[model samples]
Target: MRGLNDKVTLITGAAGGIGRSLVRRFLEEGARVVALDLDAAGLADLETQCAGHAGLLRTMPLDITDHAAVQKTVQAVHAEFGRVDVLVNNAGWDVAKPFVETTPELWDKLIAINLKGPLSLQHAVVPLMLAGEGGKIVNIASDAGRVGSSGESVYAACKGGIIAFSKTLAREAARGNVRVNVVCPGPTDTALLRSFTGDGEFGQKIYDGLKRAIPLKRLGQPEDIPGAVAFLASDDADFITGQVISVSGGLTMHG
Candidate 1:
């Protein structure tokens, strides 16, 4: 959490479960945050929730899949803040279904949101970081990408691509002092997870099964994520790059 005070931080998917938590954490650490999300109403709600830190937060509606828009937004942020200190690529979307049952349309949406969107943001922001003071990039992937999830084949593929991309980008950008890393969450209790498990006995069965399978015997909470994310984004992780940390409560582990 060190060296985050007054930092210019941008977070996508800022209206969602984990996204909101990330926003609050950064504000608490005294960072200036530009919260971006497609859900304008949700962003408003988040703003109200953090009204005490009004000057520290600004919410913007954004569709990360739009490349040109992403570039413009990054430019706007740099114009206003002078520099981007941290960029968190956290926006993602998915619907759980078997691979064969899923359609190309769903695949397109998955790739656009989970993969291309983050890539677009990085493409825009990295140059700014390289030109100015260096920055940190913390990408939110998934345990499904690291291991596998039964109903998320395409989503997992996109996340896996993110993992690979972050490592390569880290290596490429290290000399410039622009650090890149990944945080993969597992079975988190988010709206996305609830959508993944629709209402029914089947949903309950999947939920219970996951709880049982996880060594911690519970699903992950949004709050459980920011500590690791903020750490990586902060100067404390100055030496750590090209690494993937699983914040899955023992659901996934790597040596």
Candidate 2:
């Protein structure tokens, strides 16, 4: 919450769901935001939405699956902002299905978006953070990754990989003053979730089941996420690194 004014933040998956909330929160906290997403149209829409926010908003059309492009974009962001004070790896995609029902194609897409995407961004950004004294990285993983989910085998795996990767990077980046951490959301209400559950009777059934299962007796909202991310990205978390915080409303209590 502190030391965030005018800080430059680059957020991936900035056009949807939790990504959208993260962008809004950062800007509201008086931090400049560079929003990156595959949906150029959505990015443009977001810019309009944040028309008069306390801080500025700049949108870039990005596909995190491409390493070289991501690297190049990172360079451009640094060139434009002079520095990236925070990097939130929030871009991800997944399809709900059992592991046995999943295919290689699905696996590739899942890995590309959820896991490799963050890795590529990190590869490019961490060095720049080191050169600039330090920066913060908050990766959005999922509760599925932390404790597994019924219909998200591959998605869970990718998120699990993200959690592991964050810890390892946190260890490697600490000396360089770059802090890495992860925020895992439990069955949150997002477009992705809707797509996963569908907009039909079955979807409603699935949604109800999840809500009943969570200890808080409800699904999470987009707004529920950004506070944790904002904390990690701000000086408030300067002493924190390699930690995984789950905003699942008591869904998975892992000690």
Best by TM-score: 1
Error of 2 at 37 (Å): 0.2
> Candidate 1 — which pairs collide?
none
Query: What are the TM-scores, per candidate, against the unseen true structure?
Result: 0.99, 0.97
| Model 1, span 19-63: residue lDDT tens | 999999999999999999999999999999999999999888999
Tell how far residue 159 is off in model 1, in angstroms: 0.3
Per-candidate RMSD, Å: 0.7, 1.1
Q: What's the true lDDT of residue 46 in model 1?
A: 98
lDDT of 2 at 207: 89
Q: Give the range where candidate 1 is weakest over 10 consecutive residues by summed lDDT.
A: 246-255
Candidate 2: residue 66 lDDT (0-100): 95
